[model samples]
Target: MNRALPWIIALLISLTANGVMTGIVLHRVAGSPHVSDVVRHEHRHPPRDPSDAARTGGFNVRAFLRSLPEEQQQIARQRFASERVGFRELMLAAQNAQQDAEAALRADPYDPQAAAEALGELRARRFEIEAAMEAIVLELVADLPPEERMNALAAGRRRPGGFGRRGDRRPSPRDRF
Candidate 1:
């Protein structure tokens, strides 16, 4: 019993030591600036580009709303949630309209009337969707203070930089100004 007890005690001590060492290493790593930067980059939300919004099927107005006060943000979020249903329907209808228009244009012998009708349908769908989007945007910012609306607008207008991250944007020394 005595022999086994000493071994058990040693085992417990070793396990505790191992855990403490692991925690210390992790804490050091977590606190390190380079490590933190990598971690931050991993977790940070990328800024939204309005052009990408079309591909995403919805604009990220939610991200822009973060600049608003808490109460206003909540109101905006709720409005977005409600409008999403209508937005989804509009998207589907527009997609179908576009497909129909393309199919008409591709038809043999080129039925001008059919192509014109499809074009009208497609344009109507596009205008309706655009108008709906504009209405939603107007409603969203209508209650917002001008400053916040500006902030939201500015945030969305950020286009991706033309150069790659490491690519130098500055002109060469010999280049004319």
Candidate 2:
């Protein structure tokens, strides 16, 4: 027992060190740089008050649909009402499922076969969630008035552009040259 004490101490130290290193690496890798930017930008450019929508001719699906050609508006209203889950909710569910699977894998890293099976199930569930989201969005957008559909597409594009006008601003001729 006395001779084994040193080996036991070494094993504990190595395990503790490995756990700390793994935590640090995981935090860095999982941190969302884009989400931080979006939060910062929102603070800087606070959205117009909800009440201002009427005056600003801002895009509001319900309002836009009400104003669209009656037939188109009716279809859009029906489509919008029929959607089961919003895009954001579906994405969140998929992410949660993935995180749960990762946590399970971490808890039992020694069981490769079990981990692989868990991972496969997680992936399949994620795909299903994403497909449901896509179907919802497609169903809603498909029946929307053409103008409203265009507006929704444009709004979605605006989110990524917040990171940089890198999306729209063409490269200067000098840079190309």
Candidate 3:
């Protein structure tokens, strides 16, 4: 035990020194620059402008797209591209309606009637756009095989978490929402 004693003490001291050096290096690096900004965790969807987000209404249809076979996906893309003008028009109409509503509200004295009319128009535009999107979705899937359609539907219900069994282990945050 005496022969090993000095070696053990030296080993412990070396380990302590190495640990202290490592901690100092970590502290210095963490404090040296914009570490928090640089070390951010990856997110599926990074922050985006509210207006840009409004384009999709938080409806992620990628599940359905990815579930489709390659040929079908190409067809769907072409179909969506063809409807680009319609989507753009709907977006512009909705944006203009919102702007009109805000302008009416900010008028010398708020014009409740004008604001209400603008909001009503906005709502209608949103519904119209939603319907158009639904139609496009239907068009995209119409040619898909039954199994593929089922896969896409499955993907759609699994965004935040799978809309699986009622007796699931735990409720997802989306469930609370």
Candidate 4:
């Protein structure tokens, strides 16, 4: 019983430590300002310029291209054309990996090993695609005039998918004002 007694005491100590940490985290979370309060605070002080949204986060290449003047657009298009084929190929591979992962997960025998391998491949493919996308965005941003770069990057702050709030087209900076 001596050996078991030491183990039981260790378990009790671990549990107590975990409980204290959890309570501390919960208390901090409860004391934090609510999301609505933060939103209200922000709304009280609007951006000086609507284009400020682009400087903050999210990058939609299509929207960025459309915002450029015709001459700049032509330059950007030439740069993008060379990369688009590889980007599309990467995207297709990622999609196929996703399908394979899904199929592995749904297999009749339910092989955990196979599912894990498929998921790993899907993750790697996704990482490749994301890297390719970041490369394209960075190159484009570098090529853009300083004044327009932020707007290009900030295209998707309020929503996901980078296109817009509802997966539709994103409104240009002009459309906001």
Q: For this target, which candidate reaches the highest lDDT against the unseen true structure? A: 3
How large is the C-alpha RMSD of every model relative to the true structure? 17.0, 19.8, 13.9, 16.0
> lDDT at 80 for candidate 2?
50
- N/CA/C clash count, model 1: 0
How far residue 143's Cα lies from its native spot in candidate 1, in Å, is 2.4
Please provide TM-scores, in order, for all candidate models, with all chains considered together: 0.50, 0.35, 0.54, 0.51
Positional deviation of residue 98's Cα in model 1 after best superposition, in angstroms: 1.1
Give the winner by TM-score: 3
TM-score of 2: 0.35
Residue pairs in clash, model 2:
none
How would you encode candidate 4's per-residue C-alpha lDDT over 46-161 as one tens digit per residue? 43454454553344555566666676667667766777789799899999999999999999989999999999999999889778877766766676687787665554333234
Which residue pairs collide, candidate 1? none
Off by over 4 Å in 1: 1-63, 160-177
Candidate 3, after superposition: displacement of residue 137 in Å? 0.7
Give stretches of model 4 more than 4 Å off: 1-58, 156-177
Runs of candidate 3 exceeding 4 Å displacement: 1-58, 160-177
Tens-place lDDT digits, model 2, residues 38-116: 5756445545454454344433333333334556645655665455356456567667777866876788446777677
- What do the candidate models score in CA lDDT, each in turn? 0.71, 0.59, 0.74, 0.71
The per-residue C-alpha lDDT of model 3 at residue 8 equals: 95
Cα error, candidate 2, residue 82 (Å):
6.3
Note the clash tally of each candidate: 0, 0, 0, 1
Which rank order by TM-score, best down to worst? 3, 4, 1, 2
